[model samples]
Target: MSISRFDKKIQTPPENPSQNDHSAPEEAAQIGAARVERVIHGGDGLLRLDGKAGFISGVLPGELVSFAVLRDRPRQFEGVLREVLDPSPHRCEPRCPLAGRCGGCDWQYCHSEYQLELKKGIVAENLRRIGKIPLERESIQILAGEPWGYRERVQIHTDHRGRPGFKARRSEEIVLLSNCPVVTEEINRFLEDAASGKILLPPGKRLVLVLADGESPDSRAVIVAPGPQTAQRSLDGLPLSFDPSSFFQANGPLLERLGRELRSRIARDAPRVLVDLYGGAGVLGALAVSGSSAFSGDLLCVEEDRRNARFIEENLLRAGLKEAQIRVVSRSAEKALAVDPVLKNLDPPSSAVILDPPRSGLSATLRRWLKKGPAARLFYVSCNSATLARDLGEILGAYLIQDVTILDFFPQTAHVEVLVELRLKG
Candidate 1:
């Protein structure tokens, strides 16, 4: 196997902690020593160490941990657990069977409430530290739904050799996964069958990404990214169809709340317009202002992927909405919102623009458009605060930060999906 580009790092390398090298232990190799730098940079109380990448494992920040070198390269080093000479106050036993091998959730050993705090701190740090933007989050709205079994999405992966399960972190090695502790029971059943090879995956496919709709196992949903088209079912009469490899919010109940969180900021007026940027299957735009009996309005969703745009268009028609009622802008958000004058003319003037950009956040041209556009309100949904904070700083002049809700959407992890509501300040 060839060494990947990320493997090249010049850090002090661990001499022996690996099975590949028998002479390492005796050499007393020199490796980079990074402080368990800070959880959420001190928010989560998580002690993720810095310095040489692969040299630290089984040990967290604030506690001395020597890493077991897995692979050493010029630019980076891969490591595994060696020894934890000391432990942090937040450290606890991990409940999952594959705690060490499974790449799903690393902080499962950490407590639940502590996990939420870590997420909060992570958001605050990304905004204030990385982005260098100030946000008074000490008293912010933090929605912690459930610590366990809250995940509505599950992705099952296997190796080419036909072993059923997920690949170990940073490697393609398959780990048998008959059950997942964090997901609902129904998903577990389906996953168990798939893992046991009872449900044969397409001949060569080795991945299964199951996206559920509601909090329970009974929630109807979609499956993609690995294979299989998606069909969504909801009591609210939502019939969603998605391609095999598109971006869809897997959490159903949380997604509804996410939509409600955005809707709470909008005025309850029919005929209102919305520009759903990166509107995967138009879910966000559909959430912003659904064509319910009590509400009547236009939703213009802009999706770059042609296949996703088709799904959005089909979903709207399935709901008995006029084709004109929902305009699927096949162009990029920037092109749709700016280069194409036709998009700005969708509704009288969009009352709100809801955006869910990729981890990289919004493009520069699109950010500038939102700042100067006619949208009265903006709902910025972000999965990564590092990027969000930076983007927020760029468009601060266009909108004022009215409220930020730190939702524990993804628990047992350092990731926090935040919702920021903004109204035009000037």
Candidate 2:
């Protein structure tokens, strides 16, 4: 069935209020069986129950499963997997014992190879449905690294007893875990050390661990407490440091690959000026300037957080750009575009802009600006495909989609990072 048909069925109201909300302590009687129609963006399988759309986790497309509805809405019902009557051939046992309970790795039940396929299909569907951009399967590139032990950064939530763990799926309950397999080996070692009293941890509600050098025994990682700390690391031979609170790409190898891709794409565009919006630690800005042989113009990194200015300055300095050539603006993207005189006169043919906004995508003002005054080359790095599609739909009138690449930054989970290249239409 087409996704459009499913959309129509979702709008249909439920026949009875009892079917809409089940507030009883006993919901087992409401269990129903349905074949999963498809997997949606959030990695939930879509199905139909009594002509109403149903969503359940831990199931695959085309699998017949029984589920218990946890929450019911007008159009769709959220459910939990009860029994897999007919499991998919690709199903495999999760590595972690807390697979279904811990919210860290939701797609651990599926094989690594099939996980990429599902993410690609979901991205394509979002582009076609939300962005109105129908892209061929072959044209969408996929780059992935090791499925396990690639994460360089992780957040560990704690309980009242100071036990380190992760939050459970869709609940406030904490799932205590001694170690996570998805993080780097060094991190796991640190966790083991912390658990075994080899290291002491200050009392905090949550802890953020960043592994800069896994091989170094002396100071391989920094265990950032509930305060400000600098996490130092290098990517693709570029020295970098950032506030633990600020954002940084988690996967190492995949991040390096992304750097190479950005450099190559920017070089092809041959932009004289480069602007990095939402520039965290100036990672992308530095990467683009360091490797691009054709890049000659000044580099501008606009970041809203004032605490990141020092890090951005240091990183850009190390990127080989002269001190006079690098400009760091401490302002939001919208404010910078509106107030900064330098950002107002961007040469369409010689300017390149990189957007790495939060999951909400571009601001409304920024979207309007891009649609009217889009640069020659636009590189958008997004973690949410839905927001990316929404932003692209608004700005596609002036920009042509060059290509979209999916990077499996968060393996064993439903999250996928996407990078899109756009060029202004002549």
TM-score of each: 0.79, 0.91
* Per-residue lDDT of model 2, residues 146-225, tens digit only: 99999888888766656677877666777877789899888888777776667666544778777664346444655564
Count of clashing residue pairs in every prediction: 17, 0
Q: Mind giving the per-residue lDDT tens digits that candidate 1 earns over 1-426?
A: 111112223344443332111123432333333335445532222222233334343334465554534446775564444344456777787778687666676577677876666666677777887667777658457767667776666666655645457666556666777777778666776677766887656534555465545446555543545555555645134556666566666556677776665555664434367667788886666665544554456667888888688788777766556787777778888778666554555432446677788888988887776667566677788887788888888777877887777867767655678888777765
- Model 1 lDDT on a 0 to 1 scale: 0.62
Error of 1 at 77 (Å): 9.7
Best by TM-score: 2
